[model samples]
Target: MTSDGDDTTVLSTEEGWQTIQATIHDARGAMYTAGSTAILLMWAGIISIAYLAQYAISTFASDFAEQYPWFPGPLWAALTLPGVIGSMTIGHRAGRSLSTGAAMQSVGIRVFLYWMAVVTAAGLLPGAAGLWNETRAETIPYVLVGVIALGHVLFGILHRPVIAVFGLGYAVSFYVPHYIFEGIAPAVSGIAMLALLAATFVWVHRTGEW
Candidate 1:
């Protein structure tokens, strides 16, 4: 009963609404992405600054020890560990889905592993000096194993057990030369950690888990 021109007009109106809805949806998605990225980057940066400050203060004491026959305190700079896992886990769970929650759970497991194997041990470092000097090969391996274990757990190829094994291997292989070799250890560790994170990001994107 409708004229041809009337049908055409009705179809055009429907298409316009569909287009508008799509545009709005796209805009919302972009906004969320931008906002999340900014917040995480800022949070991570702040955490990094805090970690560095602690490291610097720790360095001051250790340096004094160097001149006065002192030694690094029982602390090996622990501030960096908390925010590394804490902020990312918080960011992931903010408005994400069940899978992200699960990944973060695994991350938490790794962190617990670090705490048991590293932070607690860091507290007991003073006692270790009595057993062996820092310059000895024995102590270096222990430090590397603990710190590398932390890296593997916090930044894994997946939220699976394989990453933990790899991390353990890395810890075993770390030598003092690497730790003090022109300050490359820190950079290398950072990159390796990022590799795991990069993989996680890919997984999140491909699966739409984020």
Candidate 2:
């Protein structure tokens, strides 16, 4: 950044990078809020459909578990599919250029979806196949932190502040799941999530970047 009386100086490469990051940080907030809303809508639709499916089975169905076990109810509530899609949509709109929006955001969001799809497929596999191996789910954060966290840094390398903000959301996703799923405690999990989000919100506000 340079200064000339009453005239803004053009940013050099490094300063331009900072400017891009600030823009992305603003964009991420919009994306998350939009994504959350989309996911809630998806939850409503999924629950409604799942309930109807169960009703049909109850009314005229037979051996439902033998054929249609592993209802998508809990999966619907998990909210990853819709959330990831919604986030991706926002990311498309958030892109700095077509390259970032089309190539990067699209691929990143699809990576998340692919991950979930694979997990679901595994559950559908023959033999002792289901997602509830406590030990397996326990490793989710580690896998994500190792892979997704690195993905964040690599893809968002140009946008430091944006990645930092998104990282907060990502980290909270990991920690909250442990309390909510492993501990089977919602109250504690909710508080932890809210507290961390609030702190991040305050920090963002103080920074006045977004």
Query: Which lDDT values do the candidates have, in the order given?
Result: 0.43, 0.43
What is the RMSD of candidate 2?
A: 9.6
lDDT of 2 by residue, 103-177 (tens): 444534543443344334433432233334433432332342334334343334443445444444545554566
lDDT of 1 by residue, 89-201 (tens): 54445434323555434533443443345444543553565633544422432453455456445544433344455455444334333566554554444344444445544
Provide C-alpha RMSD values for all models, in order. 11.7, 9.6
Off by over 4 Å in 1: 1-65, 68-75, 78-118, 129-144, 147-159, 176-210
Which residue pairs in model 1 clash with each other?
A: none
Pairs clashing within candidate 2: none
lDDT of 2 at 179: 53
Off by over 4 Å in 2: 1-78, 95-148, 153-157, 165-190, 205-210
